[model samples]
Target: MSEQALTLKQSGVRWLWVAIVIFFADIGIKLWVMDSMGYGWANRIEVLPFFNLLYVHNYGAAFSFLSDQAGWQRWLFTGIAFGVTALLIYWMSRLPAKEKWNNIAYAMIIGGAVGNVFDRVVHGFVVDYLDFFWGSYHWPAFNLADSAICIGAIMIILDGFRSKKLRTSN
Candidate 1:
């Protein structure tokens, strides 16, 4: 009814759109990759010295951690994902108007988490395709959702450090 109320509603809508876009796009790509490549089909094509499109499936979290667990991890991760998504939505909804970057970071994390969570819920595993390697060392394989989460984390960290630096310098 009031101007301030209208503004708040619009801002909330915008953030909802952001979350939906990221979540849907991540899920769509992952589904396409799964269907086109099939599970465990590594269509390796070296994009650079360090990057490769190496397909893989992960039944657990980062670095295939917990992938070999005996039981119950699938449901555990699904529950965790749902909890994180709910928390992110609540946090993003409360973000001030000036905190657009923080909202964006949260959206990324929420969407990415949901994308992988969907896979875990439906298939009991997350599909990973992107691989990075250098000489004898290799990074963990990941997919679009993982990439989104990584970028979101970096943005949040940068925001925190930047604000801290500015406060100290002033």
Candidate 2:
């Protein structure tokens, strides 16, 4: 086997392992939360004044927007998730194996997307818990999957900024 081919194989194996671990962890947490807490049930084990453990179901995109649609949104979001996940997987595999943070960002996004996709496919909605409030204002409830996606987005942005700074410095 050529050296390039061997490197590619090793990278693919590493990415696969990373992806699997992320995917399974996301799914496993969701499953446990669902089974233990039951759907739309909030335990409210108050850890702070502004936080609560409240489970909510989201039938549409962020903030429950389009949740009341006559119906079509389910399949639309599902298709979008699948397409984006496919692209992320391809990009992740093509990245240099030594770019650890970039690889981490891609894997996180892939895992998060897969987790929400599973929910959309099975229940036609995503289950959200983790809630916060401030005075009269409240933030939308979200789950582990959404958290992962947000973290991934932050990491990607930071990575880009760091790379740009390095280029400019040189």
Candidate 3:
């Protein structure tokens, strides 16, 4: 194999640690929330004017898509998360070390995916606790895993724009 390919192979494995860390942190926080607050809105703690620590269980995809359906969504979402995690691992493995933003993005996605997958398998749903609201309007409750995934996605988009700018400048 070429030197560049070999270097990528060696260095790419190191980036997986970022995913592992995110997974552990997500799980740990979820456990803490579950233990401290139990389930439902009665235990919600208001921390700020626009923020609260509330527990919710998501049985479907983002924003509770298909949440009103029958029980099939749990397995469906779990399967999708597993598939996405595998794809992220493959993509991360192929990326060169110099692609720092891409590496971080993939790692965060992988970690978050695995974390939510664990919850689906063990609890039949994902536990969400972070709550943000503006007066009576509220954003959907989400957890650390969701936050990591969002951050990763944003980083990927920003990196794409940066890459495009660099290409045009050159």
Per-residue lDDT of model 1, residues 52-77, tens digit only:
77557798897888999974788888
| Most accurate candidate by lDDT | 3
TM-score (C-alpha) between model 3 and the true structure: 0.92
**How do the predictions measure up, each by TM-score?**
0.85, 0.86, 0.92
| Cα shift from native, residue 62, model 3 (Å) | 0.8
Residue 97, model 2: lDDT of: 72
- lDDT of model 1, residue 49: 92
The TM-score measured for candidate 2 stands at: 0.86
User: All models: lDDT?
Assistant: 0.78, 0.77, 0.88
- Single out the weakest 10-residue window by summed lDDT for candidate 1: 10-19
- Residue lDDT tens for model 2, 5-123: 77776553256555667678767877776777755534644568998776567998778879899758988888987898788777766777777787788777777878888888888
Question: What value of lDDT does candidate 1 attain over all alpha carbons?
Answer: 0.78
Q: For each candidate, C-alpha RMSD in Å?
A: 2.5, 2.4, 2.5
Which pairs of residues collide in model 1?
none
